[model samples]
Target: MSFNWINESTAINLALALVITLISYIVIRRLITAITGRIASWSSRSSHGWTHYLGEIIGRTSRLLILLMAIQMGLYVIDLSPAWESRVSHIWFLVLALQFGLWMDAAVLLWARSALSSKSGHQRSQLTMTMISLMVRTALWAVVLLSVLANLGVDITAFVASLGIGGIAVALAVQNVLSDLFASLSIGIDKPFEQGDFVVFGDIAGSIEYIGLKTTRIRSLSGEQVICSNTQLLQQTIHNYKRMSERRVLFQFDISYRTPTEKVAEVAPLVKQIITSLEKTRFDRAHLLALESNALKFEVVYYVLSSDYNQYMDIQQSINMALLKELEQRQIKFGMPVRSLEFLEDVPVIQRASSDVDESRMVQK
Candidate 1:
């Protein structure tokens, strides 16, 4: 029997294409699974766990691409109108482009992790890697979007002009956010502080808990979390205390003025020896600075051979207690200001004689 375009040929072709599309999907999914499994096996052998991550991203990307292509081919085979077919194709292409960008971004992260493993001492900040990957993906997506627009025969010149005009207002509305984002970028590049570093800016001092796109989270000494804008953090002078291998401890005390100068000199050396003998404390310098209005001033400056704040305070307390006990044992008294007036018998007699002489002079007159 002879067949015409109007009757049955279209339905038969569509059914065949549908079956082929389903078969393609199943085969492609199996291929993706097999490829991912092999990659996981290689990762176990190669000692680079990051490769496993890369494989998973690629596997999913491959499955998506295959599904998209199968759908497009099936639609074309079903004898749809030209306009509808074109629209579907364009949509599929856009989706494919977006997925491709995502896949590329994932690959970038996996590569960065591998690079970090090869090098020793100070890995690249994860925030930095994330920002770079995002920027790269954004640029790629921008290109892909523009390409799709061009394929659809959009007027590129007019679109560029409109974007330029609208961009100014959008920038003004979000300038603060943009500033913070750029500042975050600068921080990632400059690396003034990283996660787990103790930082002090103005009166806000804390250990960095997280570095985000526009803010950084810090855990304060009081155990409160503080979220600060990156723009402000970059603007201030940051004190990174975590980088220091030692901490400096300085303080002053007073001794009695009547204490012998020789004894005062001996006190410094004794204190020095005591501090140096302690664990994780260094004897830097101690001196009898001056005799004050009420008491003699003594200054002690030393280094705690550790960055631990608690240990530093503990060492300082021990030194202070030892010094106080030593002074008491030496019978050196602490100075105190006293105000008093004493009248002696000789002073009274002199005053009486002066009064008598004045009275005799008045009588003679």
Candidate 2:
């Protein structure tokens, strides 16, 4: 009938602390939920407002952190051994560190999403946002982990030093991979080419199909996929044909030298007329560029207002056919390779003596 198992004061104090802790937890939990809910409601009212970030952070608050706070408050009222207090303190620190890390992770993700969403006409690159979010979360968790270790009386100096050495080793082992990863990041940020862009780099001409972390996949003109390292791609010169607003075309042709000079001069004007008559074309100039041993060369320069290769080819084919027809009507001929050979009318001939005559002459001598 006598509760003598424990000290009366200690028992009473412990019971009171437990009751206070429970009451505090319920009250704090309800308060947090109410406040966060109200903020969320307010944010929802203003769809495009800065209060969304605040509401998000508040909503992400960890229930474990609230419980930890209640426990700490209750424990503060009880008497405990130094060892027990130390252990509890370390546990609290660990929880706090983990909770902070979670908050940071959430914040980073939300910020990334918001930034990407805000991009209207020019959307931010998804790959870049993903990389940024990953790095931020990783760094945050790393710091939190180190802080927890240090709080638990772990010697972080050696651990950090070892980590640095390990990092260096890892870097050296995967330097090329790291280089490509960074290059991919650069590509995302610099926007040298985007997905579905026609690009020529080195000897490869293709349309970018996928831009990845280590390599970019391209659909080659020859109907094959080309996988190129991002580092190598960045190192080479890239010709992004998709960015070209107009294409300049230079073409040359030859006419027979026997063509009348007056008619030969008409070649340039005829070409200009034909080119200017075509839609989406701007004729720059046409001239007799050179008189070679084989033919008279005419150089023509024009611009195609379209960047489409097929459109350019079609325009060029039409112009060529029209010019050919016109030349035929004018009795003009295209130059052809010709060669001539000359022969002497008369020539002296030398013949070798017979073997029998040579043998007889040698016998007589």
Candidate 3:
């Protein structure tokens, strides 16, 4: 058998082209890496979002893509068959499509992050931002996938129609879940309450731990988790204590009925003084509200300037203690539950006639 080797001219050309491609790849890759690093550093220092996003894209672009480009150019130096050339072109198209998709996905993420960060406290909700990011990424990838399919000469019309029908079926199957999901989105937008906010919805009072698509988990006051569907939660009246600017407190206490009318009258002014003496308290009104069967009821109304429950409790306690001390010093008494019983002086007693007759008979015998 006779063996034929490649021609010297072709062999030399291939070797030279390969060596130059390798050297160019190393040099170009390093240059790109260095430039991207510098750009990233500079963009990081700047507050402009677009610049930073551009830098991030540049930094994240795969070096292999650059190498592939170099190799494609190098292949031109060697004469290749039409079939091989067509294969290389397809390869380039695929790589470029994938790289473009990645870049677009990254851009969406970066923009979402920036938008979330720039929002005000009332406008920014973590779940909302996450959902927005997810939707944007999904849409971007869908477009990319369609482009890739088109590039590969795949007819996607029927595929897209089938996807729509499948999506409708899936949505119908998960309608309840979808309802809750939309409710969660509404909560994010309307902001009835956010994570970490203390809220009372229905009979459950708790701090929101997490807001998810279908369910919102709350850490209840009794140290248990309360998981409620977002749809159900939205249906209830939510008392968001976190948003309260001040707490208006109306409390009543009773003094003994034995207290003199003048002293009872003095009680209101005394309570008002006690409440007004405390910081962050606004005394609204104190009055001898009613005369009950057992005691005279006094009503006190005040506002705590702070939303902090602990702070309000502390102020209320201080006022209560001071009021108690004042009443004690003035020889006043607090009302207590009392009961009364009456007794008759005299009552008739009846003896059994059978016992009397038996005694008489026994005596006679």
Candidate 4:
């Protein structure tokens, strides 16, 4: 639309630029408000979900930055010196980069907080979450700063190289600590085990007591606290007993060889019956696996339908107690050592000859 007020140029078109910039700023702000308000309304409809965070991220767009964007748009219609244009371009780059960094920072913080909050009883410490968030933000802002400096015609090659060397030195200085820190993060996110979980890794068996940024404290079976670095803990193959669905059990017992053949044959079926009568047991198979010199060895296999050690013990005890009673009812005797001769007093000494004639002379004959 042609208008008289459109081209009222003065002093590098400051008058027109100001008018345009003000109008643009008003329009953009209104648009942002309307859009963000709608998102907030939608968030309210839900049960305080991620939508609320979405609205906040969008709403956090700085008013000063928005004004600068509007000014950049206004400057598009004006004539300026090469030096001024370069300055304007640099400002634009810096603004956009800062805004991007802010957005990324918000998302990272939200993610870290939610990750910590979501894991119930996982023992992800506040310090861990803070350190993680700080490290990521530091990296992000460093990239943004470098980009801005490069845009302003500063030579960043030397700066980048120096940073690389410095970073290497720092990392090497704290390599062990860093390794444990990152491993702790892995544990928090990947969750091989949680607090109070019974875990066995290598030779260490314990219940997790605390998870820290550098180390994990565990209460061992012998009532001693075992402190292990997160790096060392994660390096080994872990057995999470707390997460075990079921337990496989195999046991062996022997019965006397003198027991009747029928009774020996009945052992397997009798053992199976006893195990089946107990709750939380899945009968597998029972068999007379081997015959010893003095006993018949029977092997029994089954599954405990629980991971609880006490429950398994209770079931085993019941099986053992019932076994002896049932065997007594069937008149079957448990295995015992074979008979052997013993002398109570010394006998008459006899000397053996090395030759046949001498042997006959030494003998009773």
Number of the predicted model whose TM-score against the real structure is largest? 4
Q: What lDDT tens digits, residue by residue, belong to model 2 across residues 237-347? A: 899999999999999999998899999988999999999999999999999999999889999999999899999999999999999999999999999997989875543
Best by lDDT, which number? 2
Candidates sorted by TM-score, best first: 4, 2, 3, 1
* TM-score against truth, every candidate: 0.65, 0.79, 0.69, 0.81
Q: Model 1 off-target regions past 4 Å?
A: 1-3, 6-31, 62-64, 67-99, 105-138, 184-230, 240-245, 254-262, 290-297, 306-311, 334-365
Candidates sorted on lDDT, descending:
2, 4, 3, 1
Q: Indicate the residue-level lDDT of 149 in model 2.
A: 86
Candidate 3: regions farther than 4 A off: 1-20, 41-54, 78-89, 108-132, 182-191, 210-213, 222-224, 252-269, 285-300, 308-311, 317-365
lDDT of 1 by residue, 304-333 (tens): 988888888899889978887888998776
Candidate lDDT values, in order: 0.82, 0.89, 0.85, 0.88
lDDT for 175 in candidate 4 is: 100
- Tens digits of lDDT, candidate 3, 281-314: 9999988888888888888899999999999989
Between which residue pairs do clashes occur in model 2?
none
lDDT value, candidate 1, whole model? 0.82
